[model samples]
Target chain A: MISALRTLLLCALAIAMLYAMRESMPGYGDITAPIAVRGAVGERVETQDFAFGAASVHLARAVKVESFGRVKDYSTSGVWLIIEGAAVAKTETMTLMSAEWQAGNGVRYALSQRFSTVSGYLPTERLEPGLPRPVLLAFELPETAVDKGTLLVARSLVMPLAEELSIALGDRKPTEIKPSVTISRSAGGAPWTLAAR
Target chain B: MSEKRTFWTCLVALIVVLPLAFVVRAWESLRESQWLAIHKVDIVAEDGAPQAFAGGQWKLLDMRRLPRSDDARIILAEFEASPTDPAILSQGACRVRLVDGKGRRFEPVALAEPAVRKMYPEVADRPRCGALAFTDAKGGAAVRMAESFIVPAEARDLSLRIEFPGASEETLVFRWTRS
Candidate 1:
């Protein structure tokens, strides 16, 4: 009898945890997602025209996100659209920055070299005309003297085909790598391209 | 008969008590997922601790916002302080306002007390510049001020800028992009 009661108690606790975890799951919200980019170009090239009247790459409203242990379900938000990027060819070596992540387990772990560049919609004023505003392109290098553009390496994060998804507290375990980002050439914003540095 | 009675009694308690416990737990979690709990945050550094800056704002360079679910506070608005700066902050003299994708700025469309209270209860009409220096040149102790704004139920794109007093010859700009 005691064992059965304990089992019932344990089951109740598990369900409560699952439900609570789902309610408070932390996600990086509102990114025009499922953005696709091509890395074949050996040199810096702009893709403004794809299958759509759109530019070089594309971004769907769909977001591609992953958690610490696994990928979560697609967020209720619209898929992020239009992802723009510059290819570094195969030979360019990329440098990565390191950071720490706090997990739900109350343990801190190092997420080293999460990626080489920044992720988000770039600000206008850095791109050429006919280029999208703040294209969803990541850098292959850092702020160093490297001829024309800043230094960035050739690396890409894969957007996992999420079969199942869930959410959790980010304070305990923030995201380390985002497989993709959203971008666009014109939403009536300024162009975001590299300045002559 | 006694054994059967005890069995039923325990069974009834299990069915009734377990769900009640669950209700209480779910109530707590619901509260947690709602709006942020902190009503007003005033960070100030005293003595030798690292002090923070007051009423500051930061904008990212490359990030696109397509309106979706409201989950995270994408931009850490009005909370700008560098490790090289102080750790603590002061927001006694200042307030903040945010301009998001929506036309609403400081006050919402209705200007209702509850609505205004949510976004700009502590923010000043304008981000005023104060002569008070929070951090010293060496990055030691300092004072600062600001009103932290909590995100409401609305789901939309957000582009924000904070205005504060100028402290140097060049324009003070706060920019950051996270990968």
Candidate 2:
């Protein structure tokens, strides 16, 4: 009986160890930071180098654009953007989103579709909804374009699944966020403050 | 002897196989690049007048008389195509876009703040856009603060969609802000 009990305990210990290790795999992807983007709309720059570089030029001085709706509930970004005398080739902003991040580069990136309802928010009902949400990522350019004139329409970015799990598991971080961009120059030469939440 | 030997072998296998299994699972999660949802928009202008309206908020603060050599109190955004023209002191407006180093494109999704734009379809396309300056005979010059805009912090990595008037599409192509 003593020997049989010891064997059972050993088996249980190994199984528990395996379970813990499996659970730890996702956290190995503990993503912490939010990724942001800035964009603009203009003509393809004229260039001879063959590859798209800054010198390749486009020409436009004014533009206007509008977007609205929620990206997620906890977040809200919707506005109508009007650019005056803005160079088409100049940097611009459109939208920004963030979720709880993983620690390493363990993220799986796939071209998944999003669906929005009349409210413009991602529905809590289904993952693959019937209606297609206009995922406008195909318009994103290179990082080099993140300069001035960049206008983005941010709505709601959901808490990453990992972060949500952490919260559910009682791990929460402070909400006071330090921004990546400085307030040196305003978008439309307009002086404004980024009221952080 | 048989039972003792079997127990010892099982213990060894448990330690070795467990670590090896973890190593394999860990390797499966690595990715070459991070894919982010974003878009690219570029703009350019050619009037030497500062752009007052853009996709975000903008204010015209007259700081020309503030002090000398400080960021020009006047602001010009070279979001794209940094001018390399030697004789072209100012080519008017410039371009801007949002992109990640890795190859992926975003779209004009939403607007975080308010913005505006101006154009003179009837004017001769040159001289300058945004703000312009002429070199005084003595070399010191006066500055003109024409247009400017304020970009919001949340506008990054998002697709920019602008509304323009009279264009064939009325939707000013994302990169159509040109010089």
Candidate 3:
């Protein structure tokens, strides 16, 4: 009877300790720290690249292609905004980084599909340190989205599922998240400039 | 009497611990199962020239910015096209289909003819509409398929379906965000 009682008491203590440490543990909830950094166009901002090395983005401009051949414009109610820029890598080799544009209206537009077929346009390019890779990420959005939108360029096209799982399982170290870049139209509206971080 | 009492206690402990150990082993096995072997799927704009069947012939799709109502969005998707066999040049054709949030099914424009011409323009009238294979530096083969489909401006959610030869059909969901 005494031994049984002791075992029960020990189990209760273990359960209590686990409950107390739940919040302190990494995978307990979604209350983790923000991983992205914020910066403006033209100004090169360093981002969290994990083991791929240091990365920087320079937002160039937002342009709308009026027409291509006899097909006319594809977007009926919206226009395609081709975000032109370059990303430079330092140290390690990098894979294609997915880019997304979030308008001030809260609508998020991914890279455009129509314009990717155009020659000399590269949306996915491996970035190695030294050489700057030209970025031509396009987004299909309403004309209202052009003037103000935040551009997010990250290594994963989708949520980092593997990393999230590893972090939850406590199997791998958590990777730092770089800040997203904010893009705004210039005074004359010819070019989009990155907002100050 | 004391010895009998101790034996009963020891047997009870063994019964509990043995089941716990089996449960842990089963959990580990499930975690390592092949059900988790889903390949990476990516949706991006078709780079270079997009070839599609137009006017009873294969032609290069114009890189035009068309309205969603007028023309469908042309997107390129990448997947693990590496075949288990190195001798297999083609991994067969893939059927690309999409279903919108509102239950609207959108079939990708016909790509078989264009696919053949793009890969083997020199070979005339061949109907080998399989995925175009390219060997990487590591001698592993990868395939690329260019497909076009229409998505309404108000589409809240989109699910892309890809059916490769000899493999189960897979559906990839695109969760759209308004803000």
Best by lDDT: 3
Local accuracy of candidate 2 as per-residue lDDT tens digits, A50-108: 11111111211111112242122211121111111111111222222311222123332
Candidate closer to the true structure by lDDT (higher is better), 1 or 2: 1
Q: Stretches of candidate 3 above 4 Å error?
A: A1-34, A50-76, A119-122, A159-197, B1-179
Judged by TM-score, which candidate is best? 3
Q: In CAPRI terms, where does candidate 1 land?
A: incorrect
Candidate maximizing DockQ: 3
Worst 10 residues of 1 chain B by lDDT: B60-69
The residue-by-residue lDDT of candidate 3 on A120-194, one tens digit each, is 244545453333545555566675665556666665655533121001101121132112333343443223343
Candidate 2, residue A80: the lDDT equals: 14
Q: What proportion of true contacts does candidate 3 retain?
A: 0.00
Docking class of 3: incorrect
Model 1: per-residue Cα lDDT at residue A149? 17
Give DockQ: model 3.
Answer: 0.02
lDDT of 2 by residue, B1-179 (tens): 69999999999999999999986776545332244323334342222222323222122222111111222111122221122231333322322222322212222212211221222221112122222322321232222222222322222222222332221122222222222
